[model samples]
Target: MAARKIHTLIVGAGQAGIAMSEHLSAVQLPHLVLEKARIAEAWRSHRWDSLVANGPAWHDRFPGLAFPDTDPDAFVAKDKVADYFEAYAAQIKAPVRCGVEVLKVERGPGGRGFRIDTTDGLYEADNVVVATGAFQKPLIPQVIPADAGFLQLHSSQYRNPDQLPDGGVLVVGAGSSGVQIADELNQAGRKVYLAVGPHDRPPRSYRGRDFVWWLGVLGKWDLQTPAAGAEHVTIAVSGAQGGRTIDFRRLAGEGITLVGRSGAYQNGHMAFADDLARNLDRGDANYLSLLREADAYIARHGLDLPPEPEAHVIIADPECVSRPVRDLDLRAAGIGTVIWAVGFERDYSWLEVDAFDAAGKPVHQRGVSKEPGIYFLGLPWQSRRGSSFIWGVWYDARHVADQIVTQGRYTAYDQSARARQAAPESAIHAAAGDPDGPYPHPHL
Candidate 1:
């Protein structure tokens, strides 16, 4: 294939990339998106078959579009969510080329722009936006031996309970994915053992409103990253069974054994951290904090939302999980599979740029990197806490698009184009200095 030049090039066609494409197309910016797989491939292929989105459809969709023929409060099934992305791309007429795998991104000839080498052909672009997102590589710890008799799989590789071997299953990690899988497997009549860890236990719905709405109304969604050393954690909310709070005590009551964090696995015996009770206490505290904050907000604002008498009531921990259980022999317990629902990290091996630090993480203020003409999207805490959600990506992408459109020579080109077209998208510039400070230094 012959080489070509494009004004802007975006990698990855997931929600983040698609949202970026939407904003770029708004100002008639010439750009194209290159995707290694089909649009929203993560939702279509990677997620478990029985999985539904963690948030309600109403709050989870991009602003310009809504889930078709679905209730706003309903948690959308995984495949339908993927369909929504595909439909959105078609609706916006996003310039996407699927199956074009980008291999490397290096400086263009004469150091002018970026040269992207792909499986299809080579191309040059004046600007590049890396939108592959933060969930690039699965982090599977080396606790279990490679030659271990039990089958091990990362949560990304898991499809359903049927995919696991016939025996007890141990699910490590207590995040959203871990709890959901454990619940699914338990419902299938499989003996499931879950390993608990640090997590937020916010109720899915409180006082007749979804927790998501409460976050936005209470202004918790716009939270910035805490000063370094406060480890980032995720909420353990679930949308299964019509969405509700996650309680380990209740799960233990239902016959699923809850254990502490997983440790070493040697000679068929698996060790665990003796912190299950402490982890539960931490989650309980987070849950109570939200309830109290909601009450205070309601009183201060004089809102007419209903109140529950038992909103602040937390049940006692079940006896089985009140204290950490000691080590158990995997073979004796008949545990045949281990699902590592730990987490993921970003992979920038293909990115040949100097915008990263010694830790291999991107060094950027907001989405704008230190390297000129390069940007990133779909990163956690990119702008705020909401940056990880679908609706949040809208604002982050808009900001990046603003910086790109108002960039060096492109500003002049954009001004002339707007004059000729007789429609100026001046709002992008107007909000550049808005007080929320989602992007502290747009120029930087």
Candidate 2:
């Protein structure tokens, strides 16, 4: 059978791909979205059962619509997020084919367009938007002993406390997931040990606003990716308990023992770093930075809002973080389970394109890859700090779709970009209707 042809093919049905579909459809552009599972599979299947969106409902959505009948400050449950994406996709009339997994994506015969191999069948497309999102595979460090006798799982696979064996639980990585899971297990009367790391601890609410509101007000979400060292630091904010602040000392006083970073494992013992205080301090610094920024913004604008006393009250590091536990004997601690929440890394090995860098990450200029007819969406810091957030991903998805529509290159925006590239560097600036030489597509 001849390969199915599409003008534009999208390889995800999450927020990014769905948003891209909406933009393309708005302009009457023909496209189809393909997903390995149903829309927003990660939200539906990967996350823990009791998990809620890290962002509140008001901000955790596409620009076109607000979450249905949900309060602005409410942190919608994980299932609701999936429902929102599905509803949004339906509302947009996005043509998505579920259970269709793309096995491989390679250049078509004679280097024209793309040949996609999928479980359903073959497809050829003029352009492909790889919107598989940033969280492709879970990253579980090899810190667990090879012959450990404890039940272990990644945060993605964790459900409720009852899903694991009854004894103590050790939750690794101090990011949002780590903290929340540890807290939940601790609350359930389970002995919980949390492996802390360098993380950003911001209050859920400051003054009269949610922290997300402050981020938008202060323009932190739109800030460009920071320099090397701090770009990948874990953000440890929670939307639990009606969006309360995350205080390590409070957590410690409540019974969750915080340990330093986990390293190697040997002889029924897990070695932990002695830098717990340093990690907590760094997170505390991030916490304080937001307060100061908010204080300055309020004073500058002469806003009526006053500082939130609870948000400003600085708490000292808990006892455990100060004098870190060096080695934890699994048996002695009665820890029967380990939840690894170390985050994820991208996996695009199936995409047979020469558009990746040395570390196998996509190389793109504002979502448009150097490789013609190829694009990426929902990557961390793709354009700014909020690139991975729901709203940011939608924002980015539109830009990518715009690039496709404007450039009209391979599928013909006459992809004047190629002709421009071939033209003499001197002729680039003077090209008709293209005042800018270097970056011709400036939708910004």
lDDT of each: 0.87, 0.87
**Model 1 poorest ten-residue lDDT run:** 435-444
Q: Write candidate 1's Cα lDDT for 1-444 as tens digits.
A: 767899899999999999999999997789999999999999988888888988999999999899999999999999998899999999999999999999999988887789999988999998999999999999889988878888999998999888988999989998999999998999998888899887788878888889998899988899988435435665699898889789878788887888888888788899888988888888898888888898898899998989976767777777767655769788788889999999897799999988899998998878998888899999999999899888998899999998887684454555544654564457555544568532333254
TM-score per model over all chains:
0.91, 0.92
Estimate candidate 2's alpha-carbon lDDT, on a 0 to 1 scale: 0.87
Please report the candidate that would top TM-score against the real structure: 2
On the 0 to 100 scale, the lDDT of residue 174 in model 1 is 86
What local lDDT score does residue 63 receive in model 2, on the 0 to 100 scale? 84
lDDT of 2 at 404: 84
lDDT of 2 by residue, 1-444 (tens): 789999899999998899889988986779999999999998989988888988988888888788888998799998999999999988888999999999999999999889999999999998899999888988877767646788889898898899999899999998899999999999989999998888888878888888998999999998887757986788899898777778877899899998988888887788889888888888888888988999999999999996576666667766786667899998899998999999888899899988899999899997999888899999889999899899998888878888887666333324566777788977766765455533444443
RMSD of each: 6.9, 4.9
Candidate 2: where are CA atoms >4 Å away?
409-444
